[model samples]
Target chain A: MIHINEQQVSLSGEHSIAELAEKFKPDSDIFIVNGYPADRLTTVSDGDRCVFIKKGETPAPEEFQAMLTARHTPGIQEKIRKARVAVLGLGGLGSAVAAALAKIGIGKMLLSDYDVVEPSNLNRQQYFTDQIGMLKTRALRENLLRMNPFLTLELIEEELTENSLPSFFHDVDVLVECFDSSQMKAATLRSVLTRMTKVSYIGSSGMAGYASNNSIVTKMLQPGIYMVGDDISEARPGQGLMAPRVGIAAHHQANQVLRLIVGEEERRRDEHTA
Target chain B: MNILLNGQEKECTDGSTVLELLASLKLTPESVVVEHNHEILQPEAYTAAELAENDQVEIIRFVGGG
Candidate 1:
C-alpha cells in the first residue's frame, strides 16, 4: 500500500513514481514523494506520500526541504507551515523579513503598507528600480510570491488605523511591527498590544547606520512583545539607514518569529535533557 | 524605598505613583508602556498606581526605523 496525497492505495508490488502517476493521475507529468520532486523513474514504496504536479508548475523543492530541516521532531514542520504572521510595513525591514519568512515556509502572511516604493528606498529597501513607482504592498506581494508561490499573502494597501488594526490582527498568530517612524510604531504597538492581547508582537528598533552587528539583538520587552535591533541607533542626516544593518535586524525579527512558531526554546530544553 | 526598575534597583520616595517614577526617569507617559510587578498598567492608571518597595517595574519605549 502507498499513500498518495495522504490517501492510501493498495499496490501489488514496488512501482516507479511515473507508473503510479500513470495509474493515479495519468494526465500529470510530475510527481512529488514525501516533499521532494520525484521523476517518474523514481521508485515509490509502501507508506510513501505521493503528490502530482501539473506541467510548468514550479515545484517548491527548496521550501519543502527547508520545512523538513526545520523540524526538531515529527510534525514540527507542519506547525511552521501552518502559522500565520502579519507584517505591518514593507520598507527595508518589513520587505526582508517577509522574504525570509516566506523562504522558511510560513503558511500565510498579511502585509500592510500604504507607501509607494520611492527612488530613495533603493538605497536600503528590498525593492528594484522597476518597482519604484509601484505600491509597496503590491511590489512586496509580487516579490514574495515569486520566491514561494505557495505562500499566501493578504495585502492591505492602507495605513493602519484603530478600526483596521483589529481586522488585520483577527487571524494572524504573530504581529510584526516594521514602521519607519517612532510615533506610528508606538501607536501600532499600543493599539495591538492593548487590544489584541494574545497575539505575539515582534518589532524592530534602532537599525540604522553601519553599527556593529553585535549591537543588534532581540529583547523580550514584555510577555508577548519582542524587540530586535540595537535600541539606540537612529537614522540621522549624516548617518542614514544601510542595507546590511537593516537586513541584520530584519533577520533577527524573522528568526524570533520562527522560534515562536516552532517553540524553539522549549525544544532546546527538551533536547538538553535527552 | 528601593524597587527594581527594568531589572535595576532604584531608590524612590515612598508612596510614589507610576507617574512620579516616569517623571524621575524623564520618560513621557504616552511614549512608554509600564508594567508594575508583572502586571501591565493601563495608561490612565499611571497617575494613580503607586509603586511599593521591592516591586519590579518594566518600562519599554518604541524606537524608530524598521
Candidate 2:
C-alpha cells in the first residue's frame, strides 16, 4: 500500500503479477516515488510508493522517452508513438534537427525548406553531392527516411509565407525554427507566437563566423523557444556558421523537446512546489 | 594566406579566386548565397571574385521561414 499523487493505493505484498498488471492498466504513464520511470507491477520493496501520471499531458516527447526508459518506470513508448513535429528549415541546423527528431522515433515530421543543395553546403549542411540540385525539403525527406524507415515525413518546398505559417504549425506538437536570416527568424518567431497554437523552439546563429568556444551558447527563449549558436554579437562576416556549432544547437533543441514530453509532471510539480 | 569560410579557415593559395574556391567545393552555381567581406557576391561574378588575406567568406543556405 502506498500513496500515488496523494491518493492511497493499497497493494497486497503478495499480490500476483497478473493482479498487479490489472491494477496498473489504466493507460497512464507511471513513475515511482523516487522519480524513476516505472510500469505497473514493477517489483516493489517495503515503503516504495508509486504515482500514475496520465499521458498526452506533456508537450515534449524526449522527456517522456527518458521517463519511459528510466529505472522503475512503465516506459514512454506509447507517448513517442503519438508525437508529431514540424521542422521549418533544412539548412545546417534544420538538417541536424530533423534528423535527430526522426531517428528518435517521432511518428511524423512536417519538413519545410525552399532551397536547393550546393557544394558549399557540404561544409555544414547535412547533404551529399548527389543531392546538390534537389530541393532541400525533398532531400531531407529522403535522407530522414533512410535513417528511420517508419518515419512519416511531409515535405513542403516553398518559402514560408504569411499565408502558410499558420496552417503549417497547426496540429504540430512543436516547431523547430532553423532559419539563418535575422529577418526571417524574427518573422517566424513573430508568427509562431502570435498565430500558432503549438509551442515552438528556434535555432539561430550556429557557427556563423570565426569565434572560439565562447561563441556557442545553448539557452531557452521564453516558454518554448531555444537559441543555439555562438554569440551573434561576435559574428564576423564568415566566422560563426558551420556544422559543429549548428549540430550542437540542434542537439540542444532536441533535448529540450525531450524534456518537455517526459518531465511534464515533474516540471509542473516543481512549479507548484516552488 | 588564410580566409575564414563559414567558420573554417581555408588556405588561400595564390590566384585562388572565389570562383575557383566555389568550383573546388563543387557547389552548384545557382543554389547558394556568398557574402565576401560584407558584400553579397552575385552568381556571375563569383568566378572572378578575388579574395584577400583575412577576408571572411560566408556562404549561406537559404531556408524557408515566414
Candidate 3:
C-alpha cells in the first residue's frame, strides 16, 4: 500500500513531478519522504515513498540503503533503468561524469561533444590511446558500455546551438554542462535558460586547473542549476591542465547529479546543518 | 578613482593590492569571486596582484549549491 505521511494514496500511471507535488504537497516542512534516488519527487514506487519522512527523521545510510534495495520493486528499478540523461561535453570533466553515471546504472545516456579526443585529454578523460581521432561521443559510448553492458548510451557529435537546444533538452531529467571553452559554456547556459523546462537540473563545470588543492568548489546555482569547479582557480591563458584537479571537479559534479537524483531538498537541508 | 569593495566604493591609499582591498572591505578571500577588467580574476593571484586606475571590479559571494 502507498501512503504520503500516513495518509493512504495511490499513484496511477506515469506522471510528472509537478503532478505528484500538486497532489501530495510533499514540500511541507513536516512531510517526510523518500523514493526516486535520482529524482525524489518526480515519480516513485510504493515502497520507496514508504520510507520517506521529515528532513531529520530518516534512518542511517546503511539501513536506508538496505531498505531501498531489499524492497526494490520492479517498477522503481525499471524507472532508473529507463531514465535518460544528457551530458553536454566529453572533456576531462564530462568523460569522468558520464562514466560515473553509467556505473550507477542510469538506463540511457546521451553523450554530446563535437570535439576529437586529443592526446592532451588522456590525463583526466577516460578515453584510451586507441580512441584518438574518434569523436568524443563515440569514444564515450564505447567506454560507458565497457563499464556497464546494460546501459543504453546515445551519441550527439555536434556543438549545441540555439536550434539544437529544443530537441536536446527533450525528455531528459538532467543536463551536465562540461564544456572547456568559456564562451561555449556561457552560450549553452543562455540557450538552456531560454529553451526548455523539462530540464530539471543543469550542472555546469568551470575551471578545474592543475593545482589539486585550490581547484574544487561546488555551488548550487538554483533549484536545478549547479556550477561545479574551483570557480576560483584558473589556468593562465596558455597553461596546461592536469588530471587530479579536473578529476576532483568531475567527481563533485557527479556527486551533485546523484544528490539531485535522490532528493535535493533533503540534501539542501543537510548542507544547512553542516 | 573610487572602486567598490562589494557595492560601496571607499577611498583607499595608493598602490593597494587586491589583497589589501579585500582587507579594507573586511572580506575574506574564501568567500568571494573577483572580476576585474571584464575577466574573471583567480583568487590565488589576487594577493600578488595590484589594482589599476579606471578598473571596475565585481566581487561575487560564494554560495552553497548542488
Candidate 4:
C-alpha cells in the first residue's frame, strides 16, 4: 500500500514511480516521493508517499491548503488552522516556535517581544544579520509571513509584566513562554497556570550550553502545564546558548503545541483514566 | 513529616514554611516558582505558607536562556 497525494493505493507488485505516475497521473511533470522531489525512475515501495505535480503549476491557495492538510493526519489540520497560539518573547525559542507553527498552517499567532535583533542574537535567533537593531516583533512578522502568507499575526512590542501578560493572552488556546530572563519566565508561568487555567502553558526551563540533545524533552507536568528542556542547564560563563540546543528545545515546544491543538491533551487524559 | 514535592515524595520538618523550603534547597525566592497544594503562591505568601504532612508542593527553577 502507498499514499499518492494523500489517497491510499494498493499495489500488487513492485513498481517504479514512473509506472505509478503513468497509471495514476499520466500528465505528471514532477514527482515528490517521500516529501522530496524525486526522479521518475525512483522505485516506490510500500507505504511511500508520492505526489505528482506539473511544472510551473503552483497550487492555488485552497489547493495549497489541501496539500498541507494532506501531509497531516485527518481531523488535525483544521484544528491547527483554527488555533490561536501566543508566543511570549520573540527570541531564539519563540521565533523558531512561531516559524514552525506558521509552516504547519497555524491560523493565528499572538507574538510579543520588546527586544531588538542584536548582532549577538544572530547566533541562535532566526533573524537575519541585516535585521539587527529591528524590533523582534517586526522581524518575526516579516519572517513568518514569508513562510505562510495565510498566517495572521498579532504583534505586540512591549515587555510583558505579570499584570500585562494575561490581558493579551486571555483568548489564546496555548501560551508559550520563551522569556530569556529567569525572573520573567517564572512570573509569566505563575500568571498563566494560575489565572489562565483554560489555556495550556508550554514553558521551557534549561536549554543552555552544549549539552546532549537527548537530555531535552517535552513532559506534561500536570494536565495543563507542559515543560520542554533539561530544566537544569542554565546559560553561564563557559556554557552559552547555541543554535542546536535552543532549536531542539524550541521544536519540542512547537511539537507540543501541535499536539495540544489536535486534542492530544484530552486524549491523553482519557487514556490515563481508562 | 512526609510531603509530595514536584511529584516526588520527600520528608521535611513539619511546619517548614515555603520560604524555609526554598532556602533549604538553596533556591532563592526570585529564582523559582512555587505552587503549594496546587495554588501558585505569591512571593509574599511563601513566608506564611507552611508545609504539612502529605502536602503537595511544586518548585520549578527558572534560569536565563531561550
Predicted chain B of candidate 1, TM-score versus the true chain B: 0.92
How well does candidate 3 score on lDDT at residue A215? 52
Per residue, candidate 4 scores C-alpha lDDT tens digits across A72-148 of: 75488888889999999988899999999999999899999988999989899999988999999998899988888
**TM-scores for every predicted model:** 0.74, 0.55, 0.56, 0.81
- What is the DockQ ranking, best to worst? 4, 1, 3, 2
Ranking by TM-score: 4, 1, 3, 2
Instruction: Sort the predicted structures by lDDT, highest score first.
Output: 4, 1, 2, 3
Candidate 2 has an lDDT of 0.63
Q: Scored by CA lDDT, what does every candidate get?
A: 0.78, 0.63, 0.62, 0.85
Per-residue lDDT of B1-65 in model 4, one digit per residue for the tens? Answer: 99998889988997899999998888979768888886788888999998999999989888889
Q: For model 4, what is the error of residue A97's alpha carbon versus the real structure, in angstroms, after optimal superposition?
A: 0.8
Q: Between prediction 2 and prediction 4, which has the larger TM-score?
A: 4
True-vs-predicted CA distance for residue A137, candidate 1, Å: 0.7
DockQ score, prediction 1: 0.39
Pairs in steric clash, model 1: none
Looking at candidate 1, what is the lDDT of residue A262?
A: 77
Better of 2 and 3 by lDDT: 2
TM (chain A) per model: 0.76, 0.65, 0.65, 0.79
lDDT tens digits by residue: candidate 3, B1-66: 466644566576677788788787676665555666544555577887777665667665432211
TM-score of 2: 0.55
Output DockQ, candidate 2. Answer: 0.03
